[model samples]
Target: MAGTNVLFTVIVILIYNAYTIDSISTANLEASLDEYINAGLKCHTKNPGLALAIVKDGKVILTKGYGVRDLSTNSPVTDRTIFGIASMSKAFASTLLVKLLAKHSNMSIYTDIAKILPNFKFTTHIRTDNANIRDLLSHTMGFPAHNLMRLDPKLTRDDIASRSQQVHSIHPFRDSYLYNNLMYGLASVVAERIGGKRWEDLIEEELYTPLGMSGSSFMTKVDLSGNVAKGYGTDDATGGPVPIDFAINRRWGQMGGSTNIMSNAVDISKWMLFHLSKGRNQAGQQILSENDMATLHRRRNTITAPTSEKYFSQPQVPVSSLEENYALGWKNGVYRGYKVLRHTGTTWGYSSLVTLIPDMNLGFFTTMTGDDPGYKFRYLLHNYIGDLLLGETPWLNKTTLCSFPEPWYNQSTSVYHPINKHINPTRSLNYYVGVYHNSMYGNLHVTMNTSANTLQMNYGIGSWLLYPKGTHDKFVGEGTNIVHKIIDLSSIQFHSSNLHGRSTIDSVKVISFETRAPPVFTKTSSHVNTGNIVG
Candidate 1:
């Protein structure tokens, strides 16, 4: 028996040696992944909770969960934990659309959306004449971001379409890319019409079931069971995790194309494999044809701009390049000499990123339940993994990890005109009357009536309360703590007044005052004005 025990110990030692050797062979890769994990932990100070995965050659080299999944319960995150992957849903939706197109040669991306959903009508302007399947996927249909519908928990897709009539087009049909969710919802409608199935059902049938992505599904009104990560935000002062109230109404689930995807990294990795293999499954199932895959990767335009600083230095992969605009749903670009195809998603409490490097047969998926700070964590992880893959320094230097420079504020030199300035002043008197313009925010016109002492300032969108600061100057009532003053004309030097307290008003510029327009008074009698109000 003693001899047998000694023999067993020897065998265990041999197995351990083999495992050690294997890990050593992949030392650089492991080291790089470790560096990323460290960086991710540091990001929790700002971003809080993060989960990351790195894949190379169809194998997962790293899958890590950093920070807390539920700060209240002190539950840690795991590889199998689920997260809401906001706009990343677009990638999956686009993939399924492409797959359906491949299966039915009769269907093309250029097919008119109107043909699929005849009831679909635009009150503002119809760009559907040139809009095709490709336009929706590429975000080239001239639809302004219609987020109002999503924000309203009570609104449905039908209601959103009804309200869309009130929305105006930013440009003519197919003129430029305007990232809009309305078009995506319309695309989902097309998918349902063509596939004779709901968007979620079609995804399960075409992609999830075949790839064995069992942990992924569309978010519904029901509570997500075990393995789901709760979303968290940080307190501005304490840097502690604060639970964000996420509205998971059924109506929200209907928004499948733009948001509503819930997935785990383990399951998401399989989805990445589908892209890395260029539309094929692990078992040699042809999920998408070569031509169809190529079409998905092809540049639809020439408008590649880094969405953020973290994306700037990374290498681009072959599936897409930023030189050309839209490659299916992926943003194509070059980072560090390699072609890169990537996209990011955000809901109120969740942020997600997906990136693929086709040349290296590598892909990555990261999801976290947090807000703006989480974005920093995502970028840091991506940069670390990317540098490691490119055989660069495995760790990010201090300078490299610094925040990207803020974009320059472009001054609009267009002539300013009041939307409503021809109206008369009414009773309910006021002491406020002046021309207020922040160099940064442009002009604000204020008028006060006889009875009321309340001050009103008309800027873009609508009127805001101008709290009395002194004799002639008032500070913005809203955000007063951040913006201390919104001066009345009397408080400023005759030359010019700063806009938003940032940009300097040009003293030399001649002031051309327009007549005040009538006020469309609300129910509250804070200030009354007699003028013809034009919106």
Candidate 2:
């Protein structure tokens, strides 16, 4: 009886000590936040809204929202204000697939994609399913970003999974990192086949419910209703960010596991704490062992593609960062002496950053409505919080990093010319009109508007005016609709193939549709021939 009483006293004392420690940590963070957070967010006054959550030593130090949720209503954002988290949703999918794999213990991570997924047909130099879940999650599958597949707004997960057979290789198989979202979406498709549940439900049941993220979901405005923040995009002409249509939110929901989790900072703080823990739920049940967690965070592919160099450049990267890698749904790197697991997510107008330092038990999540700030603001805020917690001096005074992110972006995106300017087509508009097709990307139907005397592309995408370039066959696409800032319009060149002494456009080269080598769509039907096409 005496021993039992002593044990109860000890447990009480331990709980008190933990409470005291958390309180102290919270006080310190609150005291430092006013100056740090306000200064860091000074430049984004024009932005619609944003939310942030910071976790340290398995405690939520802060969860805050800044600015208005909607421009017209002027409703201030709160910790619980829902926002689209974009690719940060990847980690949840990764965990779900891992859990599903554990349930089916016989299945290996190295199990061929063909054998695991139902009728998997991701074609490559090797066998169709030679690449496994690891390759898809790590993004070393050699396929470029066939992002056009997601634009249709009608394709299902099953449709996406089957269409993978059509996308050809741009990089060497298992030899390069390409950051393919479609492949990750396919991973969820694999999970569904093995687990007998839809990707949405599996994530809700397995990850969100376990983590106490009750407010998270695949939001389409209809899901969250009143609480969702409107997304915003930058307009170069207006020189300020504008609120994007709320209807655009529904498009990503159908795109599978790549990016469709809408959540709040308050709930995400719980997610940060979960990672800081030993993969145990609030009920103390072990969902993932330490080894399982390590596997999820394990470094797999090094990110070193030439176009990827912009990520490693200065001012934007964390201080003392040494190398970067792609793990299962996470970017693995070391910033200073602490290990960093991070990912930046941009879903149309919304953008987010999820950073975790497991060894230090520190992480931060930032979600914003506007695309103007991009990676710069998120990077600055995380570094500021990390510096405050680590007892380190501000390397560039924090606000300095946040002040002028525009110049850095200008330097990064200077590779391509602005699409605002257009040159006249080399021949008549009818000569360039055709029904172009790529088995992987589907179809692109080009038609001429006789009234306007301009050619239009009906790639199942928005209305794109084909503005000629270089006084020749080359042309640039300009989206007529303002909301589709996600689509590229920089370069589309027409190639002529002569047959029977007549010149006809046989192919349309897409230079900037998130494609690596910029794939070419062969002309299957021509407007000049009317009924007959090149085929």
Please list the residue runs of candidate 2 whose C-alpha ends up more than 4 Å from where it truly belongs after superposition: 1-28, 125-129, 219-224, 246-249, 305-318, 372-374, 404-422, 450-452, 482-486, 527-535
Steric overlap count per candidate: 41, 0
User: Could you tell me which 10 consecutive residues in candidate 2 have the lowest summed lDDT?
Assistant: 526-535
Candidate 1 residue-pair clash tally: 41
Across 61-106, the per-residue lDDT of candidate 1 in tens digits comes to: 6677767787667678888888888888888878889888777767
Q: Pick the candidate with the highest TM-score.
A: 2
- True lDDT of residue 211, candidate 2: 80
TM-score of 1: 0.68
| Residue 29 lDDT in candidate 1 | 66
